[model samples]
Target: MTHRRRPNDRLRTLLKEADWTQEALARAVNTLGAEIGCPLRYDRTAVAHWLSGTRPRHPVPQLAAEALSRRIGRPVTPEAAGFPVPWREPAGEDPVTGFAALCRSDAETGSRLVLQQRPYRVADARAPSPPALPEIPAQRPAADRDPASPGPPQAGAGGPELAALHDAARFFAASIDTHGGRHARSALSTYLADDVTPLLTAPRPSPSRREMLGAAARLAFLLGRMYEDGQLHGLAQRYYTYAHRLASEGGDRATWSLVIRAMSAQAQRLGHLSSALQMGDAAARAAQGLAPSQQSYVQAQFAVILAQTGERRGALSALATAERAAEHAACGQGGSPFDTYPRAALLFQTSQVLEALGDLPGAIGALRRSAAERAEADVRGRTLTHARFGQMLLRTGRLDEACAAWRRFLSGRERLRSGDAERALREMRRALRPYRNRRCAAELLALSVPLTEHS
Candidate 1:
C-alpha cells in the first residue's frame, strides 16, 4: 500500500496570508526561477500540487520561498515553506571552525552550500555583537611545546608567517580586482581551508595570534567578494559574518567596520533597504575612534544608504561629515585594503548619493571625476564605472557619448567574469533596445547582445 502525503498546511497558511491566488504564486515563483538562471514553467497546477504536499527539486523550493518572502515583506525560509532546511551558517558553532567547514564545503564540487541560494533575511542584518576574545596564555618556550601541536613557530610567529599571510591576502585581493573572482576562487578556497584556518585555530602568543586573525579576516572578506562575484549572495553573507567575527576577535576594529560596511553595501544592492540602513548605521558606530580614512569610508557608504532610504537631508548631512573626515585622511597608506579611503571611492559614493537624491546631472559629473581619479590597476572597478557612466549618459539622452562609454566598458569586460558586469551588459541591451532605429544605439545593442547571451 502507498502512503498518502499530507497537505502543506504551513504553505497554505502563508498563501492565505499573502492573499495570492494559485496562479499568482506560480507566476511569481517562475519569475524568480528565471532570474537565478533556473528556468521554470510552473503554472497554477504546479502550485496546486505543491499545496497538496508535492515537493519540488533543488532550488525550486528556495525560489518559491523567496517569492513568498517578497510578497509578504519578510523572510520565508524553505523550512517555513514546508520544505527541507536549506544550507545556512551553522548556528552556535565556533566561528573559526564554522568558517573552515564552510570553505571546505564550498571547495567541494557541487556542494549544496555553494549551489543553493538562500533568501536574504532582513532580520539577519542586525548581526549579533562580536564575541569576547578568548583569554591568551603566557608565551612558552619552543622546547616545552608538543611536536604534534599545530601552530606557527614562536621564532617566526609575528615575523615571517604573518608577513607571508599578509602577502598572500594582498595577492588574492589584487587578483580578484583585476580578473574577478571566477579565476582565483577555487585556489583561494583551498588555501584558506588548508592553510589559514590552521593558523587561526592553533595556540599562539596573543600578539601573533591577533595578527594572524586579522589577516584571516581580510582573506575571508576577499572570499566573500568572490562568492558575490558569482552571485551566490547567501554564501557571501556567511563569509562576511565570519570575517566580522575574526576581526572582532583580533581587536581589529577598523577591519570589523569595513566588513560591516561591505555587508551594508551588499544589502543595498539586493534591495533590502531597511536592512542596509541598519547595517550602515552599525558600521558608522563601529568606525568610532578609528582612523580618519576608515571613518570617511564608513560615513560615505552610510550616506548612500541614507539616500537610498529617501532620507535626503540626512544623506547630505552624512556626506558633509564624510567630506570633512576625508580632508584629514592620507591616501595610499600601503597597508591592508581597508586602511586607505581614496578620493575616487569617495566620489563614487557621492555619485550614488546624488543619484538617489534625484540629482542626475550632479551624479553624472561626480561619476566622471570618479572614473578619472580611479587607479588604473582596478580593472573591475573601471569596467563597472564606465558601464554606469554610459547608463547615466543614456538617461540624459547623450546616445553617441553613451555608446562610446559602453564601448570602453566592453573592452575591460572581456577580461572579467563578474555578475555585476554581466548585469551591466543586460542593462545596456535593454536600454538600447528602444532606440535601435538610431545608428549608434543599434551598434551598441549588437555589441552587448552576444555578451549578455554568453553570460
Candidate 2:
C-alpha cells in the first residue's frame, strides 16, 4: 500500500528527481537572484519554507520555477510548483516600482531558506536556449559626441564642475577600455557612489541638470556592464537600476534604451525568458523614433537576448530588421543618431548568435569577417571578439585553431586585466581535456597555467 506524500515529501520528491544537493540548490538560487539584480545569499533553511506549503512572495515563485526547471531538465512553470503566475505591468505606469518590485521579489524568494535546502545542479546554468541579440544602438547622437564640442555642448559650458565630472567619467571609461572589466568594476563603482552620486544628489540641483544626469546615467551603465562581464550580476543590477532612474529624470530616450538593454541582459542571464523578451520589446518601442542606426542597434541587442533564450527564429528575424534599419541610416534615408553603425559590430553579434545556436561553421565564418573588419586600435573590441572566437573554436573541436586564437586574444588582452579573457582560458582548458595527452594539448595546457595564476 502506498501513502499520500506530505508537503515536505513533495519537496523531497522534487529534489530526488532533480538529483540536486541542498548546497547546489542554494548556489543556483543565489545565481538567479543575481540575474534579476537582487543579490541574495541564502542558506539551507530557506528551502524548508516552500516544502511546508508556505508560498514565497510574488517574484520568488518565478525564480523558483527557473531554479527548479534547471534541475528537472524540463520547463517548470510557477503554477507547477503551486505558485502565483508572473505579471508584466504596462510601460509608463510607475516604471521604477513596477520593474524594481518584480526584480526584488524574484530575488528574495529564489534565495529563501525553503528552496536552498534542496539539492542543486550546476548544468542548469548552461542549459541550451535561444541566442541573445547583439545590436546595441546609440540612444542620442548628440550625447554620443564629445561633450566639449563647439555646437552648444548638450550641457552648457558654464559649470566647470560639470565639465570636471565629464572628464572624470571619460577617464574611467578609458581605463575600462585599456584594462578589463575585472580590473575596472570595483573602482568604477566606488567612484560612482563616492564621487558621482553626491554630485547628482546635491542640494539645489540646477536647471541644466539633464546634462549632469545623462553623464551619471552613462557612467552607471558602463559600470553595470563591467560588473556583468565580471560575473558580478547582483551588483550589476543595482548599478543598472541607479542608471535607469537617472535616465528617466533626464528624459533621455537614449539613456532609457541603455537601461532596457542592461535589464534584458540580467533577465536573460537569470533564465527569465519571458521577462527578457518583454524588456527587448519595450526597448524597441522606446527607440522607434530615434535615428535608424540607433533603432537598429537597439533591435540587435534585443535579438541577442532572444537568441540566449533559445528563440532562434525570432533572433534571426530581429537581426534582419536591424540590418535594414542600419542600412537605411547609413544611406541617410532616415534620421540616425549616428551616421554609421559599425557594421563589424553587427557581424560580431551575428557570430555570437550562431555560436550559441551550435552552428560552428557559420560562427567561424562570421568571426572571420568580424576580425577582418575590426581595427587594431579597438583593443577592447578585438580582445572580446577573439576570446569569443577561441571559445567557439574549442567548442567545435578545432583545438589547434582554438589555441592559436587564445594566444592572439591573450596577447591583446595581456596589457589589460580581463575577466572575460580569464574565462576564455578556463574554457580552453576544459575543451582540451579530451586531448590531454596530445602534444598540442600539452602546449595549450602549459600556456594556460599562467593565465590561471593571473586570474
Candidate 3:
C-alpha cells in the first residue's frame, strides 16, 4: 500500500527528529540564501506553510533540504519532504511530469529518448519561471566563500587546483570548437575519466576541490556539445553523464543547466520533438528562482529548443520573454558572470529559431540585429552569423543578397582558425550548389579562394 503524508507533518517530523527549532531552521535558510547570493528571508510563517502543505518554489525546497542535512550532519533530499521524487516521469504523464522524467533519466538513455521523440507542441512547453542564475559577488574572496559555491575542492591544494582545472576546461572547450569533437573525442573522454573523475572522487574534499570538479564538469559538457554538433550522439551522451555527476557533486546549477542544454540540443537535432520539449521544460523549471541574467540565459535556450521541436509560435513567445528577462537582468543591481548575457547570442538564437520555422524575413532581421551587436573582436561569432545568413538568403532565392552575405562572411573568416573557416566555406558552397556555374555562384566561388588560401 502507498502512504500519503501531509506536507506540514513531514516538516514537523523532520524538525523534531533533527531537534531543530523553527528559529534555527529560519536562520540556516537565510544564511544559505545569503551565501548563494540569493538573500532569502525565511520566517516562522514560511515554516508554517511547509506544515500547512504548501510547496516552496524551485531551489527553495532543495535549499531547505541541503541546509537541514548540513545541520543534522546527514544527507537530506527533497523526497523526504513529501514531494514527488525529482526528475521521475510516469508513462503517459503530463508535459511537466515527462520533462521531470527526462532530467532524471541517465544521460545516455535520456539523450536517446529525446532524439527519438520528434516535434513538440508550443502550448506544452511553458515553464512556471525562468532558470536559476547565481549572483556572483563582486569580491573574489567573498564569492569563493559564498554558500552559493557549487562544489567542494579537489584532493590537493584548493586554489591552485581549481585555477588549473578552469584553465584546462577553457582550453579543451576552445579545441573542441575549433577541431570538432569527432577529431578529439577519445582524448577528451580520457581526460574526463582519467584526470577529472579521480579528482572529483578523491578523499578529503574541500571547497576548492568542488570548484575544480565544477570546472571539469563544464569541460565535459563542452565535449558533449561538440560531439552533438558533429552528429555523434552516442559519444556525446557519455560525456554528458560525467558532466552531470560532477555538477551534482559541485551543486552548481549553472553547470547542470549547461549539460541539460547540450542534451536538449541533441534531442532537437535528432527530431525528437516531444523529448526535446520535455528537456527544455525541465531546464526552464530548474532555472526558476535564479538571477535575472541566469533566467534570460535559460529562457533564450528554451526558445531555441522549442523552435527546434517545431513550436514556431511558442518559440517566438519564449524569445520575447527571454529578451524582457535579459533587459531586467541587465538593469538589476548585482555583479555576476550571469550579467554577460551577450545580446549577440540572444539575437543569434532568435535567428536560428526563425530560420528553423521557415520565416526568412524574421530570420534575416534577427541575423542583422546579431551582426550589428557583434563586436569586431568576436570574429568567430560574426563569421558564423554571416554564414548562416548567407545560407538563408540563398535558400530564399535572393542570389545577389546571398552572394553579398557570403563575401562579407568570407572577409571575417580571415581572423578565425582554419578549421571553422573551412567548415563555413563548405556550408556556403553547399548552399550555392543549385546555382553552380551561374554568374552569382561563380562570384561567390571566387571569394572563397582567398579565404581558403589564408587558411
Q: What are the per-residue Cα lDDT tens digits for candidate 3 across 1-455?
A: 12233656766888887888887888777765533324478987777776667776544665577566765766666667554444422446432223223333323443433332211122222222322444453544543433333433334546665666666665665554344444454565555555555555566445555566567767767666655544445435545655665666556676666566556665665455665677677776676655556667777878988777678788888888888877876663332232346688788888888777878799899998898888655666777788888888777788888888888887776555534456678879877777877998887876676665542
Question: Best candidate, lDDT-wise?
Answer: 1
Task: Report the lDDT of model 1 for residue 435.
Answer: 91
What are the lDDT scores of the predictions, listed in order?
0.79, 0.62, 0.62
Lowest summed lDDT over 10 consecutive residues: which window, candidate 1? 145-154
Clashes of 2: 35
Regions more than 4 Å wrong, model 2: 1-152, 155-158, 203-207, 308-313, 328-341, 356-359, 395-397
TM per prediction: 0.88, 0.66, 0.59
Preferred candidate (TM-score higher): 2 or 3: 2
Q: For model 1, state the Cα shift of residue 192 in Å.
A: 1.0
Instruction: Point out where model 1 deviates above 4 Å.
Output: 1-4, 27-43, 66-77, 85-89, 112-116, 130-157
Tens digits of per-residue lDDT for model 1, 1-455: 12235898989999998999999999988766544445578899988888888887667777788888878988888889887744644688887788888877777877844343554444566644643433334666545532212133245567877877877877888887799876688898888888889888888888788778878888899988887777667667778888988888777666777889999998898787887888899888867766677789999999999999999999999899899888877653555566667788899899999999999999999999988987877888888889999999999999999999999999999999887788788888888889999998888877766787665
Candidate 2 lDDT over residue span 1-455, tens digit each: 12222465555566677887766666777777655435577656666666666666655666676687876868766677666444532345343344333333323634423222222222322211212222222643645542221112244432766666666666665566667666655566556555666566565345456656766667777776676666555455655665666666655566666567657756675566666677777777676656666777778878887787788998888888888987876663422112235677778877767766778799799987887787555566677788778777777778788778777776876776765666666776787778889877788788768768874
